[model samples]
Target: MSYILEILPSLLEGAQLTLKIFLWTVVGSIPLGLIVGLGLTSHFVPLKAILKFYVWLMRGTPLLLQLIFVFYGLPLIGSGALTLQRYDAALFAFILNYTAYFAEIFRGGLQSIDHGQYESAKVLRLSYLQTVRKVITPQVLKIVLPSIGNEVINLVKDSSLVYVIGLGDLLRAGNVATSRDVTLVPLILVGVIYLLMTAVLTFILRKLEQHYSYWK
Candidate 1:
């Protein structure tokens, strides 16, 4: 236990960076995804085609490759126009990757809504914006919440991928401790930390699901 106490602060420090990446990705990706998903549903064929292509590229590629590209590839082609700090590069890549996924999820949720819902909103003379805001979005949120929660938990684990860029994170911290002490305890602790985080997220999401159970 004393050994755990000794390494706890360092692990938490790394966890903080991991948490930062997860949160920023969630914050940035959700809205960007919504916009892209709306574009996917737009009547404009060209716009939908372009957004679809973007989503395909984001979703088709590996996120680790995307991170490497953001950090290393863009600079090669950027001609001094696209330099990003390490944190910025990671943030940009994570947002780009997650946005594609969320866009598809949101698109699915949007498609699930019966056309009658829109017709009903139209009968009430709601504007397009009003219909989305007051009717469609609320329903979509409930439908997509579980998927979004899953992605959020994934983000927490995926944050460790930043280690590929040599950015310190919980797993990397464990690696450092293990290398130094030649013990497996720190690695086990890291796994526990991951489990604890996912458990908390699961509990919170379950509560959210219950709150939305009114639909049933």
Candidate 2:
């Protein structure tokens, strides 16, 4: 117990890193995901094909492999233009992986919308962008908020993968503390921290669902 107390500050520091990664990953990925989702639904055959291929490649492969490739391979292939520090590499990897997954979720949400919505928006004389922004997106968000919430919760846990690239996130912090003291208590503490984070995320997402429910 005393050991746990002693390590509390270090664990909190690690939690900060974990939170930072989670926040940035969501910020960077959400817009990219929306764009990719739009591209996947594009009318242009070539554009659709390209976006489909991108989504497939990202989703089909393991994120760990993708992280290694981005961090290690890019430096080998395009060292000058794609130079990345460890933290940057982890951020890039998480963004790419999460963006692809979120894009699919967004695509699924968009597809769930009825075709009649588009026609109705057109009847209202809204441009394509306006139609999407004002009409389709709101409905889609209502339909997919639950799923997006799950993904967001999962992302909080997944941020631990940043440790693979040497980003000192929560799991890595616990590992470091455990190694020094030769005990597993720190790991348990780390798990509790992660659970707490996920709980908070779930609560926020639930609130978001309720907030958006008015649109339905």
Candidate 3:
């Protein structure tokens, strides 16, 4: 317990990093995922194929590998256009990986809508974009929210993975503290931090679910 207390401030700092990574990843991924999801279902076969390929590549590879590739391999290639520092590379990898998963979820949600709704919107003189925005998006959100919330919760934990790339997230802080004391107390403390984060996220997501449910 003393060891845990000793490392409290350090762990708190790391927790902030974890939160930053999680929040940024979610923020960047969601809208990008929506775009990818829409593109995957586009009428243009070439666009759909390209989006599908992107999703496949991101999903198919391990995230760690992607991180390494982005940070190391890309720089090795002449594509200096996307030079990324360690933390930046981790953030990029996290965003890309989560975006692919979210895209699939969004695609599923969009498809879950009845084809008749689109037809009805067209019959009522709604433009295609208007039908998607006004009619389809609302229904898709209802269906996808639970799943998206689950992924967001998962992201809170997965942010720790950034530590592998030298981004000092909560778990990394625990590792550093434990190394100094040769005690497992820091790890346990970090676990508590994670539990707190997950709990708070769960509560918020539940509230969001209820808020959206009213519209349904």
lDDT of each: 0.91, 0.86, 0.89
Give lDDT tens digits, candidate 2, residues 1-216: 788889999899989988988899999998888888878877899988988888899889988888888888898898568879988888898898989888999899888888999999899899999998888887877887788788888888888777777788788889999999999999999989998988888888888888977754
Tens digits of lDDT, candidate 1, 56-143: 9988889999999999889889786898888999999999999999999999999999999999999999999999989998898899
Which is the better candidate, 1 or 2, if ranked by lDDT? 1
Quote model 3's TM-score: 0.94
Order candidates by TM-score, high to low: 1, 2, 3
Worst 10 residues of 1 by lDDT: 33-42
Pitting candidate 1 against candidate 2, the one with the higher TM-score is 1
Count of clashing residue pairs in every prediction: 0, 0, 0
Please give the lDDT score at residue 115 for candidate 2.
92
Clash count in backbone of candidate 1: 0
lDDT of candidate 2 at residue 111, scale 0 to 100? 88
In model 3, the runs with Cα more than 4 Å from the true position are 79-81
lDDT of candidate 1 vs native?
0.91
Error in Å for residue 172 of model 1:
0.7
